[model samples]
Target: MIIEGNDPTVEPSFTLSNRLARQLWNWVWLFLFRPSPRPMHAWRAFLLRAFGASVGTDVHVYPAVRIWAPWHLEIGNNVGIADGVTLYNMNRLRIGDYAVISQGAHLCGGSHDYNAANFQLIAEPITVENHAWICAEAFISHGVTLPAGAVVAARSVVNKTLQASWTVYAGVPARPIGKRTQHEH
Candidate 1:
């Protein structure tokens, strides 16, 4: 409900405090978080936690991953977010345990309302359930939920909530291509 029906011309999409906090976070990310060594996962987690992110134990969020707002992220235990991933979580983005967000993947939790004259920004939550594997370069749209053990093939574009668990999805508007072997994690 960030900017649901408001006109962008008249009012700012984000509050002044929010903008200022983001600016501060950008500086911190550039100097402290982004420049950290690849093996310094604990340090990065500490930095993210300081900025209000709920990062669980042994989470492997790579150095090149770009997170728009740390406060909106909730990463569970053993989650692996690889390099070049963009987490544009304007709203809450929950990543369950054992979830793998591969390289160059984009998880966008916000979009613009095209029908609105002012193009109001719409923020929605995105959930990646336990053991879900979002393959390399995949794009997970706003409000979409990937159920447990779902495998999104490389470069797939998922704009809707996937129906089946333990399934593999591929293509532009990702459809279920096959079933994945469900393994206990």
Candidate 2:
């Protein structure tokens, strides 16, 4: 399966018209705002919303938060993305309900194929399941599936599929460390 690679129907190299518009918009936004830190609120929401983020009701995004492309982010209900959480989602990033992404967490949805010519980066969709807890400073790689109620411990590096619910994962390339509060779900 193509993890987060654009849907097969979509072309990789954009036509001139599409490229111009995208460049123009990116330039406009970059020019309009200085890249600096500040408190976040409705303005950020408006900006993300404008970029095509399917943000659900009352979703909280902090200022100083960086998103590569808002258009690819999809969050379900009651998701809490804490301050400094970086979602570098070039492809689809699907977060289920009540997912808590803590501060400094990175949902990296792009990586280069080291063996490929020029090491072209490939984007993959990340699926964070319902009621999952990605603790502070954790890094989740592209195409990873955090099953429902999974708990990723702080500073963990997750690169594989985790299926158990409410289980704690921590390590470089994270593995199960312990059980979580949730069970049978």
lDDT of each: 0.93, 0.76
Which candidate number would show the highest TM-score if scored against the true structure? 1
lDDT by residue (tens digit), candidate 2, 29-136: 465322423444455666677777787766666654557667787887777787788888767998888888999999999887776644555778999998899999
lDDT of 1: 0.93
Cα lDDT for residue 156, candidate 2 = 95
Which pairs of residues have clashing backbones in candidate 2?
3-124, 4-125, 149-166
Name the top lDDT candidate. Answer: 1
Give the clash count for model 2.
Answer: 3
Give one digit per residue, the lDDT tens place, for model 1 in 1-185. 26456678888798788888889999999999899999999999999999899999999999999999999999999999999999999999999999999999999998888888889898989999999999999999999999999999999999999999999999999999999888876
The alpha-carbon lDDT assigned to residue 47 of candidate 1 equals 90
TM-scores for all predictions = 0.96, 0.78
